[model samples]
Target: MTKDHVNYVYDPVVLKGRNTEHPVHPLILSRSSPREMSGEDIPDRELMALFDAARWAPSYRNAQPWRFLYAKRSTVHWQKFLDIVKPANQAWCHTASALVVVVAHKWTVDRETGKPKEIPTASFDTGAACMALALEGSGRDLVVHCMFGMDFEKAYKVFGIDRDRDGVQCMIAVGKRPALTVRDREPRVSQRNPIESFAFEGGFVKVYHK
Candidate 1:
């Protein structure tokens, strides 16, 4: 574990200018997506631990539809994965230790009917799994950033995905963050909107927007 992971709770870099309306876990508050990485390859053991955490995410009828396809830096598959990313993203993603494509099984086979059945909750369940993966990486002081700037169609072709049953959700860049000084940390920590702005008491309510 890095120094940030060990002292996450007390790290001035994480706690600086951040506060929640209600009390929450320190780990939740410490999580942030950093673009700058060390380009150092993560050990398979540590990397798989993130996916293991993702396995426990809740899903509709326990479908567990999420799947992660990844390529580590300096590997044969690295160029292929990188090619799928957009130029703007590639600028920063080149330093990522690993690139992962999170896919969801949009259909599941029904035992009773012995036929493919649509899974409406596939995307929602997969998102939860992605959150678990990101949180786990954050807990380990790793940069785990998700992006939508990849060619989904190209990914399907490159990965040989079944378009009829599977859908690409998003891409994830995982890596070790470069050591940071306090002066350059603020931009890395994003602020959240207050609960009242997003969470309504009972149902949806009209809210003003900029």
Candidate 2:
């Protein structure tokens, strides 16, 4: 167990964005994903608060089809959750206070037809829930990091789900931010592309221009 990591309390990296860029909340600007973490254990009440935020996210047809499986660092299931992480991620994930598996139900039975049909936005809806959960974690002064570097097949078996009915989306690790050394030694902030590059206006394939 990497419980001793709490002693390496490195200063947090501050991410600041100019207000002139956009009228965004400070929380949105300060949010960041850093690899190093202090291995302090989060209480159950605080953990539940994060999930509560996820539960309130909007979903199509009110399905809200997201499910989560989580384990605290001190629990028996902790190692099981860690096993699915990619090698590169484990370098920091091992010290997280809690690990989570985010799953999306791929299909649902229609009330009228009584036959199962694929939920077109299942994954997207789940992503929205995950984001809500992350932001909530941030509000509580906790650092949240989502990682796709997990073995989906292994997770499917570990979580005991049928591939046809459910999709193993990703994992979320939560804890206090770690020292810069826990991540790439040379810690430099990453930049998102300017709005015009990805956001489009009038038509598909057309980017928004200032």
Candidate 3:
């Protein structure tokens, strides 16, 4: 099929703002990690902006332990990035606009106490940064999909990563949202569990049932 015909198959969905006070909508709730992606290129500046948003995330002891190694979708470097993923993920991730290798350093010294500190909290800090990146991507009409299907040992060797001192947390596929058909993308709408099901009142004393 021609490019035009392919484009016709997936039309973009226009979303409008919803009332924020009416509990988080299902769209926010139903946001799932996208597996399949299209080969749409995202601007380098925009990617940088997303990382800037992640930079503002709070960290334990102010130790910002997250680091990202990224490559644009069509570059030669992208091939190296793709090689690290498992075969199953490689099939879909090959079409992503960008692949980001998320890493975290495992230790940091405490500035206040002037004592040696272990970076045991690096994973939490990295997770917070990933959330920031995702929210920023959502604001920019982009989707961020995080994945763990990678050979960390091989990746460390290939990327010259010190796995003992640093950790490979996850990989993120960032790109524009695609027009999905009912058969291709089921549930067309995102859904979420009720807040009462997960939320608790006053230190988990009782379930917060509505």
TM-score of each: 0.89, 0.83, 0.75
For candidate 3, write residues 4-53 as lDDT tens digits: 21111112232222223365544443344555555789888778877987
For all candidates in order, the CA lDDT equals 0.86, 0.80, 0.74
Ranking by lDDT: 1, 2, 3
RMSD after Cα superposition, model 2: 6.5
The sequence of per-residue lDDT tens digits that candidate 1 reaches over residues 1-210 is: 443233332334766657789987777777777788889899997798889889999987787999999999989999999999999999999999999999999888776888888889999999999999988888887888999999999999999999888999999999987876332645456688888888998899887879
| Top model number, TM-score | 1
Error of 1 at 56 (Å): 0.6
lDDT of 3: 0.74
Error of 2 at 171 (Å): 0.8
Candidate 2: misplaced stretches above 4 Å? 1-20, 178-187, 206-210
Model 2, residue 82: distance off in Å is 0.7
TM-score of 2: 0.83
Two-way TM-score contest, 1 vs 2, winner? 1
Model 1 spans > 4 angstroms off: 1-11, 111-114, 181-188
In terms of lDDT, the poorest run of 10 residues in model 1 is 2-11
RMSD in order of candidates: 3.5, 6.5, 7.5
Highest lDDT model number: 1
